[model samples]
Target: MRLTPRIVPLLLLAAALLGAAPAAPHPVEAQAPQASWSWPLEPRPAVVHPFDPPERPWLSGHRGVDLAASAGATVRAPAPGTVVFVGWVVDRPVVTIDHGDGLRSSFEPVDSPLALGVEVEKETPLGTLEPAEVGHCAPAACLHWGVRRGDEYVDPLQFVEDRRPSVLLPWAGPP
Candidate 1:
């Protein structure tokens, strides 16, 4: 096939992505290379809202998971990372940690005293959760935890739990 000018760029981009990604036997292996991440909140906080990544960036969707917590509830880091941003994201205080590998976790309405550029390990004390006046779990307080790979929103549950779903790691297939 004769490659057009536009097609050549597309092909080069695809090849670059494949070369950059870890060689996996299957797509799932490449998708989830490791499951070393930990939970952000201890005592396994109840999930008030689940992740619902939108089809588009402008579309409406729940980008993260909401954990049922109380005011002043302890919030911890889910992985070893550097504090990239620690301040208000909108109306509520937020703490964003960069876990390297293009992955980052964010907690909203948190009272984190840590400043940006601080290094933290898994289960490191981030701060306490500040109750929101008009929150997802209103009347009862909760914390909104989010994870992102670059600019793409990823399911936060995958970090805390093994997302293999089935008993076997790989899908059954005929020999």
Candidate 2:
């Protein structure tokens, strides 16, 4: 059991074999906290565009989802939060809500009457969808919804629905 010369080669071989084995895959963690958040649009508008984040921070990519909505349709808050911003970003109007815990939601092209510092509850009417020609789906108005955790943008759909990928289980023939 001591460090004898004859036992050294066997110990080295065992160490090499253990190191060569593949490591167990790490579990994927949910980026955002689970909440009972709802869709901002009633009847649940269609997702015209989906989240496609850029590989790098400064790269060009679709950072949020675009929902098909009509011009002048009422847009509501998906969860309880305080209005942190209400103004025009670039060529379209925007309303941003701070939901605490470093989570913030922003909706663009929304003609919000709500002022900054105003508290909003789930489903509260934040504003109406404003017609914009600069949106990805131009000519037809749509809502651009985005969420952020700190500085990192996250999938807004994760707030409204379970974002877990569907897994196929082993088939049991007679179940």
Candidate 3:
């Protein structure tokens, strides 16, 4: 049976709207939890140095992970959240995004254009990376990404996988 021209467009439109076509199903990779968010720097395997014995004798261990990236590289928010703090710490700007579930992501030496109370989306540019100072780091530029839950400082790398566009490296997954 031949279809009328008038009916053809309507059928096509309906199919498009309903997504009824047999298209290749996108791979069903497990979505990292909503609590899990993006990493600030361009995706790369993390280079972590164990916390020295003198650094924290009381705490369990090193509180955060250091991501290797160049200076002035864009830093993005890991998740959709509110900017709770944006200010200078020892003359270097720091921005903090609060995920509202006792989870917070923070960046140091940032040039933040966003102010406190501003809502940020996942992967939104929070600031640019700054040069690491002497004694703080050897000579390379890197982002010292950190996370805090309530009062306890935990490893930020543990919360989210590398969701950067160029690579898909598996992380330990969120805690």
Candidate 4:
């Protein structure tokens, strides 16, 4: 095919689309800006599972982190953004919050009432972690939280620090 003006742009777009495989790589990754992020679970819940990126784009690996959460624990937004999705992705009821700058967070096996495009702030009550008999944590309920920059899977915890009330020390005014 001749490299025409229209064709050139389309070709580049095709390359980018293929590069964004969550497991693949793209040049736009380093350029895409990121928002101020936080943790979806309060008190920095126990990491039942950690993100394990695949060596190859087609290899199998954990795409997200699983945090230890009760059946009905509240799951909040890690950053201020809009709800882009709230539905089933394969077998689990997932809630996805878009933090803009090509960054988004996905939490699955959750119970939420928020609709699409709902504006939420950091630590906003986005949903409640629901117990499931089938998932990464079978027989035990946990929240599967995943962060992504475009199609590239990124570590959610790396951007957040423990800031829960349980971990902070209260101080009285100096006399």
Work out the TM-score per prediction.
Answer: 0.75, 0.78, 0.63, 0.70
Top-scoring candidate (TM-score): 2
Ranking by TM-score: 2, 1, 4, 3
lDDT of 4 at 144: 92
Q: Estimate, for each residue in 79-153, the C-alpha lDDT of model 4 and write its tens digit.
A: 898999999888889999998899889999988999998999998998888877788797899999888999999
Clashes of 2: 0
Residue 159 alpha-carbon offset, candidate 2, angstroms: 1.0
Clashes of each: 0, 0, 0, 1
lDDT of 1 by residue, 109-160 (tens): 8999998899999999999999778668777789999999999999988877
Q: Model 2 residue 98 lDDT?
A: 97
Question: How big is the positional error of residue 6 in model 1, measured in Å on the Cα after superposition?
Answer: 48
Give me the runs in candidate 3 sitting further than 4 Å from their true place. 1-35, 50-61, 162-175
The lDDT for every candidate, in the order shown, is 0.87, 0.90, 0.73, 0.83
lDDT of 3 at 76: 91
Which portions of model 2 miss their true places by more than 4 Å? Answer: 1-35, 169-175
lDDT per residue for candidate 2 within 119-142, as digits (tens), equals 999999999999868869898889
